[model samples]
Target: MNTTTLLFEAPGPRGRRRCRLFEIISWAVLAGIAYLVIQTLDKRGAFDAAAWQPLGQLGVWRQLGVGLLNNVRAAVVGMLLSMFFGCFLGWGLLSGHKIVRYPCRAFTDLFNGIPVLLLLFFTSLALPAWGLPLTDFWFLVIALSLYSTAVIADLVRAGVQALPRGESEAAAALGFSGLQSMWLILLPQALRMMSPALVSQMVIVFKGTTLAFVLGGYFDLLRAATVLGAYYSRSLLQAQGIAAVAFMLINIALSQTAAAIDRRERRRYGVPPIGTGSRSPGMPE
Candidate 1:
């Protein structure tokens, strides 16, 4: 075998030429598209310096800060609630009793199937008619929590179910109750194994806070941008671009933190580098 073929099957000379041609064509197409977009935006005054001047104002910065705080508050509350309730529902779904498990399973399926926007609308609008008068802040949090609860419940369930059967059996042999074994042995391991996924869900929860703009009462970053745009006499493009940068910075930080934690966890557990599947002996068959 050729030294060059050690890592993978070597491409023939014609195949290599074809690959080079494809790469060149793809880059050229992408560059052309980018140039067109930049040109169009420039023509539309999206790059105007005057429109972005308001971003330097103290009052404008304060408004953005308040909006960001509201978003953070809702996301944090929802994430905590989701983790708590999701864990309970996940454990219930794995219970031996059909009465406990079936209801949890049904609720998970129902909520998970519903769109997040619909959930937010239902909580914000319909709930008041149903005699639950919630403020927009609470409504947003509840809506996000409800949707994330279903998703996190499924993640928890999969995490727990992925454990080896012997772990449970050994606990039973040691005279531990099923619940005790789950609490003492299984839940902790499952949580560690699923930490990366839970962090991802938290990021989703935070991003979903943007949809609170539809509620009218919630003053999130997007809503703030819209208000600023109106005040600046049709500077919507500039305000929106600033808002986009804020979101990009925040979500990028969150994603990087999550990735770092995941890498550390994988290293600690000696998991594979690509990290999709488990290499641990304790994992389920």
Candidate 2:
């Protein structure tokens, strides 16, 4: 190894030993904190197995099942709608006419910049005043879709923009209209390139469904947990841990699936390897 110092020298034996010691210390501290938290929770009766008994009851499971179904329904609908509208808006963003491009750009920026929770709140409260008469489910789905549409729009736009100029030039030479070129050539390629980003965004939309609990009318996973907790004395802590674990497991599974798809796409496309920090255009890691 080159020991020549540029910013700092590579670790010598003593430094490496110190690094290992620091790692051990960090893990020890983390374990201690975790132990303390568990002890505290136990003292508060959070570990009482009876508190979790409600989860095994048929009625309780039925309610939670319904909530899960509702959550999945909203997420699926929102993801589909977002992708549809986002594709069109993305096309508009790349349009030659300022009339199409500017409006799309402005709308995308406005919605994308707003917090999803605020959008849900605004959609839940304001639409009734505007005489839309949407139910809580529709309101939440619309809000989630709108925010996701903006994000996916930007992702699409960036993907298209990143394509090789030769593709467009060849399409023009072949006498393809701009729309034809985009639909038949560019859009397909962009979709493949941005698949990982789109999948990740879908996960975000799925997680956002939990926000529906705040609206009171939507009985999502979080609300179901709240109901379960209420049925048992001082079981809120138990319910919270259960719900957190459930969400964590679901998210982990989704991320793993996405990673698998990403690997498959990379292999199919024969794309060269990239560093960890590199990601799809206009998408955050």
Candidate 3:
């Protein structure tokens, strides 16, 4: 209650009544939407037993598992590369040298404005035309990595900026160089504070693998679902439903794992789980 009141005063009786009315209206609206959707799906025979039966087959799951593996493989590799380049570019964006900062700034502005779909298309077509024999997997990974690299670079910059200015003063008093203070002190706290946002980006990375369907010959989950639908004849919806569920489950697992690591790191390093201007892990307070 105290924390809630910090943002604004606690709701009075009339305000609480109004909130209750709003909740009731919102639920009623959602219920109406659910009923309409169910009716539409029923009219389309989406609930037919045959349409959903392939979901129970072992072979169907095996195929999905294979495609899901490709999605995970690309997403995992893309995220790693994004983080590496994101950090490097992020650091470069803050560099004292115009040579480094200007190029990094230009890179971020240029790539960040372009859509990921365009990047994927460009990579798929341009690389092969340029006589690079890279596989479609590399094409997809590279595209996703390029866009996320800019986003994460921005996150890094914002994270550091959100830190209190006094941290820099303290680092200076301890005779640390600007680079030393940033790399050792500011970046760590900034990353900790940005952990939740990073996890969200990881989710985006995984979902972006669906764009691989456009590249053809890729075994991402969407393609695998298409193959399954062809095999099962009338079960495309079922296969797609399973794929959606799989994506959701994996995303949930990723978020939870990230949260666990953030918690463990904070506890191990004797820092607040989240807050402002804290020292890096293992640094003397």
Q: Which candidate has the top score in lDDT?
A: 3
71-113 in candidate 1: lDDT tens per residue? 8889999999999999899899899899999999999999999
Greater-lDDT candidate between 1 and 3 = 3
Cα deviation in Å at residue 110, candidate 3? Answer: 2.1
TM-score of each: 0.86, 0.88, 0.79
Model 1 pairs in collision = none
- Runs off by more than 4 Å, candidate 2: 1-15, 272-285
**Error at 199, model 3, angstroms:** 2.9
Question: Lowest lDDT 10-mer window, candidate 3?
Answer: 1-10
Q: Rank the candidates by lDDT, best first.
A: 3, 1, 2
Q: What's the C-alpha lDDT at position 183 in model 3?
A: 88
Candidate 2 clashing pairs, residues 3+ apart or interchain:
none
Computed on alpha carbons, the lDDT of every model, listed in order, comes to 0.85, 0.84, 0.86
lDDT of 2 by residue, 187-239 (tens): 88888878877878878999999999989998887898788788775777776
Winner on TM-score between 1 and 2 is: 2
Question: Candidate 2 at residue 6, lDDT?
Answer: 55
